[model samples]
Target chain A: DAGVTQSPTHLIKTRGQQVTLRCSPKSGHDTVSWYQQALGQGPQFIFQYYEEEERQRGNFPDRFSGHQFPNYSSELNVNALLLGDSALYLCASSFGLAGVVYTDTQYFGPGTRLTVL
Target chain B: AQRVTQPEKLLSVFKGAPVELKCNYSYSGSPELFWYVQYSRQRLQLLLRHISRESIKGFTADLNKGETSFHLKKPFAQEEDSAMYYCALSPSGTYKYIFGTGTRLKVLA
Candidate 1:
């Protein structure tokens, strides 16, 4: 099923510019979650989407937002990016609704490496 | 606040030696813990979860609620086992996961 897939394996952007990263969930999965992993750090939860709405959000700033389409594909949008935004953006997919039995086990993609110059 | 911590930034062990990756968490309610592994040039994948009580690639972790630690261990490490390992926690009734900074395991030949 190719599992979870993300677009643009790597990206380069300047400060104050905007960028959008895309993700397609695994087959039959209905939820998508976004995470940011800085170099030498683990992945930090950004937000989660289910049923086309944001079900949960992390402590990230308002500049980081996301959307989920009907097919469960998701997009992570960052506005006015800062140099600190340079990191590996990861997209994870899981089955069932949030807090469900199987939702906590997520499958991750290759991740999009975003570099803010 | 919910958080996960992996104290060691890097761990080196000889092939066939025992290995342990330490992880501690801070959370109020029942926590679902998971160990994730990322091999070189590969995506991050789930190694094991506390609920399932199963081992993957001969690695197992026991969630000690008393000490609030879920440490991953393997009796005989192999060269293929070298990778970055992360400990994660999902608070009760939530899907968001708090991950540790991760430990890089290097199994020398």
Candidate 2:
């Protein structure tokens, strides 16, 4: 019954360095989405992965990439990070059903706090 | 462009008083709206969605397509209801959701 779980609850990285945050979707969930939440701001969608392929992406740049494993786990990787990248990275999972339905409800993880020093 | 807006950054109300959090959205096509709440030390979770047309924890929001607004309202505010509320909208052709800046609700006793 465990919900979405993320690894390395907190991470510290220097500017220009790369970092990878991991997430395991809730049990029985398939679709995984990544979001970035700056301090005092709501989350912004980065991208979404389904069946190991990115189905949709937000307005983020190519420096931000993600991979979804067959196990439904996901990893968010950011390259040449900037101070602006220092924010809480949230991972959400859902059934990826079409339109609005109970299955479309996205369950979110506690989130990984990334600090770019 | 799809966008969600929560005009109020902070809302304070005395406990037991009525509370309302306003939300407005801009979208060209059919959109699905949702209200997500994050309590202190808690994960961000879905409070309710327009499609469900259901209320949760005594909070209800009505989606007015004509006005492009979905405002969350509660009859009596409780300290436990204090949290960060985000308004999100999903466009008709995409699964991506756009969220507002969020409103922080504070209920004082």
Candidate 3:
């Protein structure tokens, strides 16, 4: 398996513009999660999707949203981007079981480098 | 609020020297802790998880619930071990993870 794959290795946008990043989960994986990593900082969880529904969310604002398709692929959408939003957007996939913490081992992709001007 | 902290931004050690990357967390309840590593030009990957109690690439971490720390350590560091290390915390029954700012380990020759 290719593990996890993300599209558009890099992106550039201006303030108030929107952006969408895509991710394909590892083979047989059913859960996908999104994270944002600012330069020199660790990744921060944005949210997670399972069964095509958002299962959990982090402390991010409403402008950051996501979707999971039936094929287990996922997309992260950032609306009205700001300079602060420029960062590496990461997508992780895992086999999820409700209320099961051990199955939450996530495999991450190369991540998309988003630069907002 | 759940949070993970890796106090040191960078750590340098000579090859074959001992290495330790400090990680601390703040949370209530039983949490699952993990260490993640990112090599240059590579994706971030899991190094080890507390629940598994296993070591990866000569690194091991013991979760100290009392002190709320999960420090990664290796007796003999190698040049290949140099990378960015991150400590993460996942609350029980939650999919979200809280990650530390990360420590950049540089093993000099």
Candidate 4:
């Protein structure tokens, strides 16, 4: 079975430009989450989407946003991207509340490397 | 603020040696801890979660509430075990994960 997949394996943009990244979850998964991983660091959660609504969010700024589709696919949008935005964006999928009582264990994708000039 | 910390940036050991990757967390509420590993040219995958109490790839992690630490351990390290290991935490009933600065393990031959 295919695991989580992300589009635009690599992208480049200038500061102040907006960018969007896409992700398709694994088969049978219902929830999708976005994270940013700087070089030599672990991922930092941006937000989580379930039932096409944002359930939770991390400490990211307003420039970061996301959307989940009825099909469980997701899009992460960043506005006014800065130089520090150059990092790997990872998308993770899980079965949501149906699979686990607390929180579902997440499976990640290969990630899209975003570079802001 | 809740956070996860992995003190070591890189750890190297001979094959067959015992391996331990230290992780510590700070959270106000009950948290679910997890270990995620990323091998070369691969996506990050779950190694073990504290709730499962199951060993994967001969590795195990026991969550210590008092110490607020969950350390990954293995009796015999294999060369294939070398990878970037991240310690993550899920705050009470939440899906957002707080990940620590990862440790890169190198099991030398």
Scoring each candidate complex against the real one, what DockQ results? 0.77, 0.63, 0.80, 0.79
Candidate 2 C-alpha lDDT tens digits along A5-36? 99989999999999999999999999999999
The model with the greatest DockQ is 3
Candidate 1 lDDT for residue B90: 87
**Alpha-carbon deviation at B17 in model 1, angstroms:** 1.0
Tens-place lDDT per residue, model 3, B2-108, is 89999999999999999999999999899999999999999999999999999898899999999999999999999999999999999987778999999999999
lDDT of 4 by residue, B1-109 (tens): 9999999999999999999999999997889999999999888999999989999999999999999999999999999999999999988877789999999999999
Pairs that collide in candidate 1 are: none
**Model 1: per-residue lDDT, tens digit, B1-109?**
7889999999999999999999999998999999999999999999999999998999999999999999999999999999999999988877789999999999999
DockQ of 2: 0.63
Q: Model 3, A80: alpha-carbon shift in Å?
A: 1.1
Model 4 pairs in collision: none
**Estimated TM-score for each candidate:** 0.96, 0.96, 0.97, 0.97
CAPRI class of candidate 4 = medium
- Residues A1-117 of candidate 1 have per-residue lDDT tens digits of 999999999999999999999999999889999999999899999999999989889999999999999999999999999999999999999887444644457889999999999
Query: If you score just chain A, what TM-score does every candidate get?
Result: 0.95, 0.94, 0.96, 0.95
Say which prediction, candidate 3 or candidate 4, comes out ahead on lDDT: 3
Could you tell me how far off, in angstroms, the CA of residue B73 lies in candidate 4 after the best superposition? 0.5
Arranged by DockQ with the best first, the candidates are 3, 4, 1, 2
Q: After superposition, how far is residue B58 of candidate 1 from its true place, in Å?
A: 1.0
Candidate 4, A20-96: lDDT as tens digits: 99999999999999999999889999998989988889999999999999999999999999999999999999987
